[model samples]
Target chain A: MSGVADDTAVVVDQVSKKFRLFHERNQTLKSAVMRRRRIVADDFWAVRNVSFEVPQGETFGLIGRNGSSKSTLLKTLARIYVPDEGRVVMNGRVSSMLEVGSGFHPELSGRENIFLNGSILGLTRKQVTARFDEIVDFSGVETFIDQPVKNYSSGMYVRLGVAVAVHTDPDILIVDEILSVGDGAFIEKSRKKFLEFTGQGRTIILVSHSLPQVREMCHQVAWLDGGRLRAVGPTDEVVAAYGASIEAESS
Target chain B: MAASYARELIATRELLLNLTMREVKGQYRRTALGQLWSIINPLATMLVYTLVFAFIFRAEPPPGDPSGLDLYPLWLMCGLLPWMYVTRVITGGVASITNNAGLITKVYFPRMHLPLSVALSTGITFGVELGVLTIALWIFGGFPLPWLPLVVQAMGVLAMFATGIAMLLAILNVHFRDTQHFVSILLPMWMFLTPIIYPISLVEDAAARAGEWILQVYQLNPMLHIVEVFRALLYDNRLPGAVESLAAIGSASVVFAVGYLVFSRHERRLAELL
Candidate 1:
């Protein structure tokens, strides 16, 4: 945990995000009239007063149950949501693999999506051109690069997404369970590529449900439960504590 | 702040270029004709209109004589060409940001780039139509007008104004989905209200006492003034005076500023809304 304080690649200060939950979407006039006053909605804080930092060139893991603000925190870091309160200051170019193939056009070929994905990740055309062959080779989809992405298998799609993202050489990489998408072999390849990326002195923020993977990759870890941080410290200790807390609750 | 914004836009130029190309290519990907459909669609529509209006109504005569030149096709083409471009930009531009909800939600770039890319892509199709129109005119013996440069300048002015409106509608449609429906209904009605099929002279003659007022109100549409400017340049070989041009420019600039403000303000929330 002290290591996070020393290098501080990403700083989250009292960050909070509030969302309006609409009970009735009320698209039609009939529905609008039937809807009660105040419109059956409430303000919900998806993330509240969350503050943490990842050190430069260190792998940090966030573990939580579903709807525990794990993905929301990554979104806040990506600048997708302007925090309702507090500030999130990131020191370098951030690339998020929150959803693989999220930006890929179905009609476009695998080759086109590479350029499209690369551009979305802030790589210039020249940069994408330079690494195009490497990306295709890494994905092992060189034979199907010219085919439309819609026809590609789910595993192939994830492989291409991972390949493009790793090739971006992002300063801070935020990944959300991307490894869970592919098969064992592809996952092994992806893990190797991720290790190579981290070896180049890049900061990584990973969110995963798999405890062992987290413990293996992360130098430090944070546990979030119900939109609040439960614990933050060295990976092994925090994971042990989190596991114990869960078992104790279930029992 | 403006300088920084301009620099950011410039920095994203390559992204914009690639995105715009993607829009153009992605549009007709599985279709048979692909890009040529851009030209063929409008040309086919024009032919249908020409046959119906010319043959049925016998409204094929030029302004003065039937044999002099068939001004009907030229008039219809002038208005239809620009109107097609404007309507496309309006209808398509609105969905530019909303349609790419995934990109907006996942990544961060200048949000304005999305709508601007749609406008630029549509503008390319419009350019091709314009080229085809020029060729048709030359073949018809309309040749080159004395005010060719002025016509080109006016077209430039109109494009700027159209782009500004496109930007505004794009942003508005994201916030209020009604804008999409409203634009669909509004465009054809707008064409009817403008002096597209008929001449302004006919309006002036019919209105008699209220001619000036009606024309003035019509001028408020901005596109009407743009069309008039286009006609004056291409047909009459003269540009509208500084006063009218300035008024058109001023209105377009205002639309642009308002659109920019709305887009930038709500852009951060687009990922959630979409």
Candidate 2:
């Protein structure tokens, strides 16, 4: 459509990542000195020749089965893992809600983790201070903010993480199945926030197994099968193809 | 490349500050004694060492010095304070990457900030402990007033050197879990090699023949110069002559450079390794 859209927020050009599976990790002095070329059992390409362009303000859904390179592709896009080949260019502030409680320290209070998670998500101290009340209210963990997060129930933890991520105001947001962690009410709240974020012209890349949600939320969708792109296009067409493939296999 | 690293560091400074505060608070949180335990840990060690040397061994003060200062505890504390801080930072630093696997795997901040935050956290404790020692010195009337800057400078040098080493060790430990065990064995031997327990002057007197060569080799160990600088500032009036000070600073800078280089080089693999 219009040859690579003018407002491209993220561009991944033929990116690939290979991880060598070592039979025995040879880090010891004796093993290193012996130098009998340690075995490489296999080279696993976690993301192989994956390419896509996400335009600014677009809601892009990445749908795939488990071990289908969805998470790996997100990580590479997030710059957590460097691609072994090709390149990824991003023209905005990117924040990933890869794991809901990724930055929470167990011994820290919910209030402390708010600042921590906010900072990790690239919000400055002044920014977090200004939005502190909004974040706490959004999470609905107001009364227990001073208590250590170790005391937080699973529902509270997920809610707080989502609340922080939403409030950080990143230009490019990546959500990886984090919505599945929280309660039903929190999920509804998260969806509202996600819609608001996208409405404000922020790019959102969502990786979820829920095909119906992907079809509803995404303008475009990409399907990954075994570390390779199976199909990518309008959400309805791609999802239908993915469904057909899955049903045929099941039959 | 350097500018990018510095920019990345500046970007993550907030995270470093928050993590450091978390570390300090987490240690004392829910504890009966709270922050006092930081002071108590080193003081307790000093008491045991003092008892063994003064009562059991019947050790005496420096010859011909009628000040009657029980300098053993003072000497022990001087060396022990910095040594313990370094050891704690190094040991805890390794876990900085491994323990935060969740953050490393998910987030895209400079991973060097993790170990650096640990070093900075320990550094706060070291500063507090130094304040305690200052009061102790004043109470004993053994304050080396003129050399205060030198002692402070030595502590700063040692802290920076240790920060560099800790950063390197943390990245390595993520890849090779055995580094943790190797460090446990290495620290004690490192202490013995440094003139921590016995002064370099004492060792020199004990072995006159090969003492110069041994002392020169000892100088090669950066910590030896650090401890010597500490002793010079606290006990002796001024820093070692300009030549020795320059040598020590040069060695420390080299180690720090190497450590940072190694840490930054390997940081990319930390997520996979962890």
Best by DockQ: 2
Candidate 2 lDDT, A32-87, residue by residue in tens = 44666554468899889999988898899999889998998999888888999999
Candidate 2, backbone clash total: 0
Q: Using lDDT, give the best candidate's number.
A: 2
Worst 10 residues of 1 chain A by lDDT: A28-37
Docking class of 1: medium
| lDDT tens readout by residue for model 1, B129-204 | 8778766766775554465676566556666566666667766666556667887898899888876665666566
Query: What lDDT tens digits, residue by residue, belong to model 1 across residues A1-251?
Result: 33245467888888898888877663433455566334667999998898887778889999988899999888888888789998887878888888887778889999999998898788999999999999999899999999999999988998999899989898899898988888899888888888887788889999999998998889999899888888888999999999998899899
lDDT of each residue in B1-274, candidate 2, tens digit only: 6567878898678888987887888888889999999999998988887898656865543421222345778767777788998899888887788888878999888888888888888988998998788667657866566666667787778877787788878877876678888999999999888777665666666557755676666667877767666655564444566665776688778877888888878777677666
Model 2, C-alpha of A109: deviation from truth (Å):
1.3
lDDT to native, each model: 0.78, 0.82
Q: Give, for candidate 2 chain A, the lowest lDDT window spanning 10 residues.
A: A32-41
Error of 1 at B95 (Å): 1.4
